[model samples]
Target: MKRLIATFVTAFLTCAAPVTAAELGDDGLHKTDWMRDTFKDLPEDLAEANAEGKRLLLIMEQRGCIYCDKMHAEVFPDPKVRQAIEENYFVVQLNLHGDIEITDFDGETLSEKAAARKWGILFTPTMIFLPEEVPEGATAAQAAVATMPGAFGKGTTFDLLTWVAEQRYLTDPEEDFQRYHARMIVERNNGNTE
Candidate 1:
């Protein structure tokens, strides 16, 4: 009887626990199973993503960044958002202040910090979505289709992922990300019990 009660208590605790978040690495960055471990070469990364039929997504973050922490804790752990990212994007994490070397698509080699500067990344958790094919002599900043500069809710994050994955920015010029997001929000609310 005691064993049964203990087992029930454990199960209740487990069921009531919050969604599991990513673990922090030694670099103080959150590590996710969907993120790819790569050599940080932009062209090679894009090629690999293309080979796998996925878009290349460069995620810029820094240690001790609150917004980045929020994203890793709340938004990324959402099942739909996680699935969208895993299925559509080859995510490569770049530390905004790290010393690790990175090779850009334009043949410029620089440290992660320098690359962030080169890309004009002014915010932590900047997400740069790239096209499958880059124009000759184009840097990553010049080639990016969309850039998300801050942490957002799961809905916005998921919409951005979906927009980029579906290539809506290229095909649906009349409807921008904001418009699409607004429509999605209304549609979602339509189904809400409230």
Candidate 2:
């Protein structure tokens, strides 16, 4: 009887250990290991501004955002997605609630959280693309580009990556995003797309 009881106790402990570890491992914030390296923090003005010939992509996220974690773990890690992002844009990750400071392209510094507030970003995994240079002290009115929000799936993410890479957003409206994306897929299939 003693031996059986001990065996059962050992088995129960082994099963419960994993559950405890899993609960503890969640950091309360849904940040993945890869997110730390892939996205950087940037100031508000700079986050909204363009990089001239350099394409800039800003990923706005907050602690405890499960969607952001999903994106980092699932979408951004895709080979094609990584390739597209590395090739086309200067990607930055900003925490919406952290107190980290970042310097804007105009040489002004602000807390990462403050900058998020200034830009009116309330959601996680917001991708803001800058297509042209934003003049010093200028607002979004002077910045010429658009911002994409939410955690996008692999297909949609890849499409957005390609669209921004090809600068298709220049003349196309949001309604044409899907069409341009399909065109890119066809072009890639035929080996005619960049």
Please name the candidate that would achieve the greatest TM-score relative to the true structure.
Answer: 1
RMSDs, each prediction? 3.7, 8.0
Give the per-residue lDDT digits (tens) of candidate 1, residues 15-58. 89844488889999989999999999999999999999999999
Q: Report the lDDT of model 1 for residue 44.
A: 98
- TM-score for candidate 2, residues paired by index: 0.63
lDDT of each: 0.93, 0.64
TM-scores for every candidate against the unseen true structure: 0.88, 0.63
The backbone clash count of each candidate, in order, is 0, 2
Highest lDDT against the true fold, candidate: 1
What does the lDDT come to for candidate 2?
0.64
- Cα lDDT, model 2, residue 117: 77
> What lDDT score goes with residue 125 in model 2?
74
Error of 2 at 138 (Å): 2.6
Residues 1-194, candidate 2: write the lDDT tens digits: 99999999999997775321112123244433333343233334344334334476667776667777777667877888877776666666677776767665545567777777777887887887765556666543135366777887887898887777677766566547878767767776796554
Question: Candidate 2: lDDT of 70?
Answer: 73
